[model samples]
Target: MTRREEIVDVAERLLERGGPEAVTMRRLADELGIQAPSLYKHVAGKPEIEAALQQRALQRLAAALEAAPDLPSLAAAYRRWALRHPRLYEIATRLPLARERLAPGVEAAAAAPLLRVTGGDLTAARALWGLAHGLVDLELAGRFPPGADLDAVWTHAMAARVAAGPGPGVTG
Candidate 1:
């Protein structure tokens, strides 16, 4: 990999291990066995590193969501991706990126599957996206009651959403 790629890869590991606060230039340089100032040659600073990581995460999420057969499958795929990569999910979902910093079309690509499932109904797609995100966030936060079957709950919720049809004013 290129030096820049190497730097971002290590930074992402640090972020995964200890969140954004842990990924300092000095720490990254030390992890690379290089002097701190050398990192500047590769990355402008922490913000650049974070943006790279976020872009990678978004791409991965878009791949995961792509080609899902139906809404339930899409929800399941999203939850699966988040559960498998909690730290990445945390960054991808919680960290707000400035519009200019976002890789062009990445966010829309990630949302495309949902839009297709909703028959291009943006409102319904957004509502479904919100439901899936809320469920995953709650589960990740350990908010579910003891003995609760999360998979069953997720299945039931998706079923209910499908049964409810599209949101008000959405034809399908």
Candidate 2:
């Protein structure tokens, strides 16, 4: 891997282990067995490191969403991705990326599959996204009471959404 990719990989590891605060330049350098200045050669600073991580996380989410065979599958895929990468999920969803700061089409490309599944209904797409995110966030927080079957919960939630038939003003 390139130096930049290596740096981001270590940063992602740090993020997974201890959230964003753990990914300081010095810490990354130390982890990579290099001086802080070497990191600067590839990344401008912490913000750039964060942006790179965010971009990578978003790309993964988008890929997961795109690979779903159907709407309910999309929900399943979303949940799986978040559960597999809770820290990255938090980074991608909880931390909003200023549109102007992101590469053109990055956000749109990620949302495209969901939008298509919702039949161009942005509201429905958003609602689906919200449902998946809420469930995963709560799951990650261990908010579910003892013996609560998460798979059953997710299946029930997706079934309910599918049965709801679509939101008001959404024809499909």
Candidate 3:
């Protein structure tokens, strides 16, 4: 792999292991067995590395979401992905994204599937995304009580939204 790709790979590992704070240039360099200054030769710095990782995460999520046959499947895919990659999801969804650093369309691509599944209703799309993210975040944070039957919770919540029906002129 190319040096930049290698750097990003290692950065992802660090992020998965310890969240954003664990992904420092010095730490990355240490993980890669190189001097801290040498990381600059391959990547701009931590922010750039983070942007790259976010792009990757979004691209993968978009692919998963796009492949879903229905809203429940879409919601399941969203939850499964977030739970599998909690730190990556956390960083990718964090506010004040480094949009300028990301490749063009990465953000929109990630959202497009949700928009489509919501029948182009932006509010509904946001609500679905919010529900999925909030539930995953709570689960990751251990906020749910033991044996909460989260699968049922997800199904009930999504069923409620689906039953509400899309807004005017909307079709899913």
Candidate 4:
């Protein structure tokens, strides 16, 4: 791996182990067997490294979405990806990249799951994306009853909406 890739790999591992707060430049340099200064040759610093991770997480998410066998199966994949990379997941969901910093088309790709369904223009597209994301977050946070799996609940909800049918589609 390139030095940049190596740095990001280490940061992601730290995130997996202890969440965002645990990922530090010193710890990353230690894990890499290189001094902290060496990281600057590759990444700007802790903040930039975290931003790199955010983009990488979105790329990983895009791959996960593409690899799913079908749309309905994606809920489980989504949860698995989130739990597997909790800090990265949190960063990916919460971090707001500076307008100039986002990799072109990455945000669009990250929101592809909802976009594929509604094919809505940007405004409606954002609304559907919010619905999908809000449902996932709320469910994961245990906002519902005990013994509940919000992922499954979300899938059922999506299925019910589709089965409910569309306007002017005719036939029951």
Candidate 5:
């Protein structure tokens, strides 16, 4: 792998182990057995590294959503993937994205699957995305009550979205 790729690979490992807070330049350099300055040779710094990871995370989520047959399946896939990589999901969705840092079309491609499933209804697509993100964030934060049947909540939410149907001006 290229040096930049190696840096990101290690950064992701750190993120998985301890969230964004743990992905320091010093730690990454340590993991890579190089001076921290060497990281700057590969990447600008933490924000650049994070932007790369965010792109990767979005690409992964888009792939998952693209494979789903319908809204319910999409919701299930989104929740499952997010739960499996909570820290990555948080980094990808929780913060304000530096859109310019992302590769051209990466953000659009990530949203394409949802827009397609929602019949290009941007509002509905956004609302669905919000719902999924909110639920996943809450679950990640351990905000749900003990024994909460989270599956049912997801099911109901998808059902509601489907029932609402596509809105006017169906263009994402």
Candidate 6:
């Protein structure tokens, strides 16, 4: 691979091992066998590197999300990705910047996978995003408590959402 591509791979390892804080320009330089100044030729700074890394993570996650056939399968796949690639998944979702800060093509590339599944309407799409994203985020955070049957709970929740429907106020 080329030098810039090599740098991205090294940065990915650094992110996978240490999360955001572990990836410094100097540390990346050290890992890359190049001086810190030379490193700037590939990535502008730590901020840019972090953004690129997050973009990479998002693209990976989007690909995984796309491979699943449906929502339950998608959730299972998401859990698997989170469990297997916790640091990268975390970096993908937890970058400490606004959506605007993300690279121009990165979010679009990453979201293409999801947007394909969530077409037609905005409200339904928003709810689906909220449900899936929230569930995965909570699962990663261990919010379900120990020894609990998350599969059953998740099924019930999904059922309720399906039955209740995202509509006008139904409360009595």
TM-score for all predictions?
0.89, 0.85, 0.90, 0.77, 0.94, 0.77
- Among the numbered candidates, top TM-score falls to 5
Question: Quick one: best lDDT, which candidate?
Answer: 5
Which of 4 and 6 is the better model by TM-score?
6
Could you tell me the TM-score of candidate 6? 0.77
Stretches > 4 Å off in candidate 3: 169-172
Q: Judging by TM-score, tell me the better candidate of 1 and 6.
A: 1
Q: Relative to the true structure, how large is the alpha-carbon lDDT of every model? A: 0.86, 0.84, 0.87, 0.70, 0.88, 0.71
Model 6 CA lDDT for position 45: 71
Better of 1 and 3 by TM-score: 3
Poorest stretch of ten by lDDT in candidate 4: 163-172
Candidate 2 structure quality by residue, lDDT tens digits, 15-54: 9999778888999999999999888888878877778788
Candidate 6, 73: how far from true, in Å? 1.3
| Alpha-carbon runs more than 4 Å astray in model 4 | 67-71, 74-76, 120-124, 139-145, 149-152, 163-172
User: Cα RMSD for candidate 4?
Assistant: 4.2
lDDT of 6 by residue, 83-168 (tens): 78888887777777446666677666655544444443335445766676677778778897788887786687667656745445
Residues 13-41, candidate 5: write the lDDT tens digits: 99999988899999999999999998898
lDDT, candidate 3, 1-172, per-residue tens: 8989989999899988988888888999998899999999987777788788888888888887888878998999999888888887877787368878888988899999888888899888888889998999899889999999999999999999999868665654
Backbone clashes in candidate 2 total 0
- 2 against 5, candidate with superior TM-score: 5
**How far in Å is the alpha carbon of 30 misplaced in model 5?**
1.2
Cα-lDDT of candidate 2? 0.84
Sort by TM-score, best first.
Answer: 5, 3, 1, 2, 6, 4
Candidate 5 has its poorest 10 consecutive residues by lDDT at: 163-172
Tens-digit lDDT track for model 1 on 91-154? Answer: 7887786558887898899889999888878888888889998998888888999788998989
What are the clashing pairs of model 6? Answer: none
